[model samples]
Target chain A: SQTIHQWPATLVQPVGSPLSLECTVEGTSNPNLYWYRQAAGRGLQLLFYSVGIGQISSEVPQNLSASRPQDRQFILSSKKLLLSDSGFYLCAWSPRAGATNEKLFFGSGTQLSVL
Target chain B: GESVGLHLPTLSVQEGDNSIINCAYSNSASDYFIWYKQESGKGPQFIIDIRSNMDKRQGQRVTVLLNKTVKHLSLQIAATQPGDSAVYFCAENIAQRGSNYKLTFGKGTLLTVNP
Candidate 1:
């Protein structure tokens, strides 16, 4: 079974501060990973998705960036946080081309509060 | 003009009643569709998926119907329960092998099951 872990589970940061959220997938290598944000009582907004290490495609251009340092590790970062960035952050992984391909399995998620 | 959309912003159904959430897509090139459920403060979870070749697919307690001609999709849940309360989103993917596999999601419909 594959599992994804995202942390810190919750974070409180002042506006304009740097932000870094980490997501790692266990039991799967070279899996496609994605970053999504969900505002309170809202749907998921795609931030970025990575097909391989150092390769990323952003869906919505915002005050955020993503990187894949290792096959199973993905990171979401920002030089400065904005109040609008406050939301629930999710990390999801899906099997690459040879595997299942379409079903995305998500992590528990991280609650970000940019006060 | 290629897009997926929901009919309602929210739907409240009584427990044990049938629930039908509707979605419309405009892209004829899209051959795969999916339904996801996002609970409060959590990530979107995969519910069901249907391909263009099939009009309907059934899973545990849930069924997904697809209409290629009109480019519409719907999810039917039998015996709605409180646990089913969540925001549901419908997404579509283009049909092709080695396709980066990006899913365009609808705004979403909130489902509130009253017990």
Candidate 2:
């Protein structure tokens, strides 16, 4: 079985601080990786996705950025965090083959609180 | 712009009752749809999915129905339980350039099951 691990499970960052969240998948290789954020009582927003190492597509312009440093390792980073950057961040992956109809499997998620 | 939206923001149901969550999308070219469930502070879990070629798909106790004619999708839970309390989101897969695709999510509907 495949599993995704994300950390820290919860984070508290001051405004204008740097941010880095790591996510990695086990038991799968060359999977499609994605980063999504959800505001409290709101929906999930796609931030970035990657098809392979060093390849990332940004879904929206924001204060955050994502990078795929390895085949199964993805990182979300921010040089300077904003108050609005606080939210629950999630990492997900889907099979690369027959990707059109594939469902995404998500990690436990990381909750970031900016103060 | 094209997006997915939900009909209700919240719903409350008694335990053992059936629950239905509705979603509508504006993009006619979307060919794939998915349902996800998210508990508080956790990543959204894949519940079920349906493609444009199929109108309905069933999982353990969940069912997803897609109506391409009206661009509406629904998720039905049989004998809803307290453990089923969570936010439900509907997502549509929009094809981008070439074989790439993006999953667009709707504002989730919070479902509360009372014991």
The clash count of every prediction, one per candidate, is 0, 0
Best by DockQ: 2
Tens-digit lDDT string for candidate 1 (A16-94): 9999999999998778899988777666778899989999999877999999999999999999999999999999988
Q: Model 2: what TM-score?
A: 0.95
> What would the per-residue lDDT of candidate 2 be over residues B1-115, giving only the tens digit for each residue?
4399999999999999999999999989899999999988888888998999999999999999999899999999999999999999999997666455678899999999999
What lDDT does the true structure give each of the candidates? 0.88, 0.91
Q: What is the DockQ of candidate 1?
A: 0.51
Q: What is the DockQ score, from 0 to 1, of model 2?
A: 0.68
lDDT of 1 at A80: 97
| Off by more than 4 A, model 2 | B97-99
Error of 1 at A18 (Å): 0.7
CAPRI docking class of candidate 1 = medium
TM-score of chain B of each: 0.94, 0.96
Instruction: Give the local distance difference test score of model 2.
Output: 0.91
List, residue by residue over A1-115, the lDDT tens digit for candidate 2: 9999999999999999999999999999889999999888888888999989999999889999999989999999999999999999999998875546678899999999999
Which regions in candidate 1 have their CA more than 4 angstroms from the true location?
A99-101, B95-99
